[model samples]
Target: MSSDFEGYEQDFAVLTAEITNKIARVPRLPPDEKKQMVANVEKQLEEAKELLEQMDLEVREIPPQSRGMYSNRMRSYKQEMGKLETDFKRSRIAYSDEVRNELLGDDGNSSENQLIKLREERAHLLDNTERLERSSRRLEAGYQIAVETEQIGQEMLENLSHDREKIQRARERLRETDANLGKSSRVLTGMLRR
Candidate 1:
């Protein structure tokens, strides 16, 4: 890490830290408050993007390697969405079948009745599958959020360990200084040797 790079990094971090913290606060907001918060974030992101583009065009050039970001945990959500959809479909079918039998009687009646009932069941299943798709999408989005949060927490704990080590060293130095304080103070108290 070059000094100049570290200096720029710190400067940029200072500039954006408040905004980053504000973004981090989204999860703490209730669903009722999210619309405004989301709008604010969307505006911020757009403005930031345009400013960055102008910077790249006129002032500082951003390298290709650092240009964009994509979340890796998104793939996990894709996988989970599929599983959630299947689980939802299975549960809905089981529950609906139980309810249908209780209300419409068991399936020992005429063939025409059974056919109509089967068609109705099929339509209901189709509706449920569509609903489940929307639900799974929303659920996976939250799952991805949660996974990212856990990752950030792990990073925070690692930084905390580093801070702990520094604190321990400072404490040790303080003890050593205290032990030698009396000898050092005597020379000062004597005004060079009284």
Candidate 2:
């Protein structure tokens, strides 16, 4: 392996070990933490896969030689790299499946299942909120009706007061006329006696 490959190999080793450790601890981790850990491991697995592919590309890029010795070494390197590639691909697939399982727990703990449940809960809450809003609107309407009724009652009382005042003035005018007629009749009687 070239010097460049050494770095990738080290990275692949570290990432693989990290992914293994994290995946092993997933079941023990709390749901909140476990979800994040699983996501991180998934990214790590992807990085590992990339490193493996890079290593394969580097092996293929080795320059050809006219001599059979270099050609033989290249063939041997290709065969070994092919086996490593297969192993890495298998591991990558397995890790990807594990990520899916972790996020979508098999037994009701799946993030996907929880998302649906939470959405339903949110919809139910919104329905209750709409009901409350409608009830408040009805309450407001009832209050407006009560206020209008009160205003009507006040107007009726004011009109009745005006009518009563007019009747009282009419009674006063009739009494004054009756007194005037009595005075005039007395004057006429005196005049007749004369």
Candidate 3:
């Protein structure tokens, strides 16, 4: 049972690690690092599925008495991993939408038109402090959204590091379990011989 859990942990670790590394390499990622993160996640997901297949084989090779426990663990792990990936993907989409809206401007106004209008308005308002203040507010609002988008991207990048740490810890745990299992198997064999 523990061994099966370890196998699932190992696969999760590997997939998460791949995604983390890919995210780390992205430069100045745009709005939630959505595009790059999505690409990396998709690739990792494929790899994870392959690893899961191998794990299934390993579980089948175990003694029948132990198979049920391991199989249950594997199923639970698959569900958890799937949920996490789906949530992460959803986050990316939400972030992308926020960024796109900010960059392209609201539905009623295109970015280009907004910019042109701002410039014209600013020019006309130059002689009037009140109008100038209004134009300035509009421009500032756009700038603020852009800044927020950039910040969100940075947060996503930081999340990759956290994800990598989690995976590394999981990998370490799996390796420890593998070593212990090997030792126990040897001990059992020796006792049987005696």
lDDT of 1: 0.51
The best-first sequence of candidates by TM-score reads 3, 2, 1
Which candidate, 1 or 3, would have the higher lDDT against the true structure?
3
Off by over 4 Å in 3: 1-8, 17-28, 31-33, 107-194
- How well does each candidate superpose onto the true structure, as a TM-score? 0.39, 0.40, 0.42
lDDT by residue for model 1 (39-157), tens: 66556545544433333342224344332212232243334334433443453454445455646756565754875676567557545654665576578667756866776788799
- lDDT of each candidate versus the true structure: 0.51, 0.58, 0.61
Best by lDDT: 3
lDDT of 3 by residue, 11-70 (tens): 666675555444333322465565666677677777777777777777888888546556
Q: Model 2 residue 167 lDDT?
A: 99
Candidate 1's error at 6, in angstroms?
A: 28
lDDT of model 3 at residue 159?
100
List runs of model 2 lying over 4 Å from the truth.
1-109
Cα error, residue 146 of model 3, in Å, equals 50
- lDDT for position 48 in model 3: 76
Give the candidate order by descending lDDT. Answer: 3, 2, 1
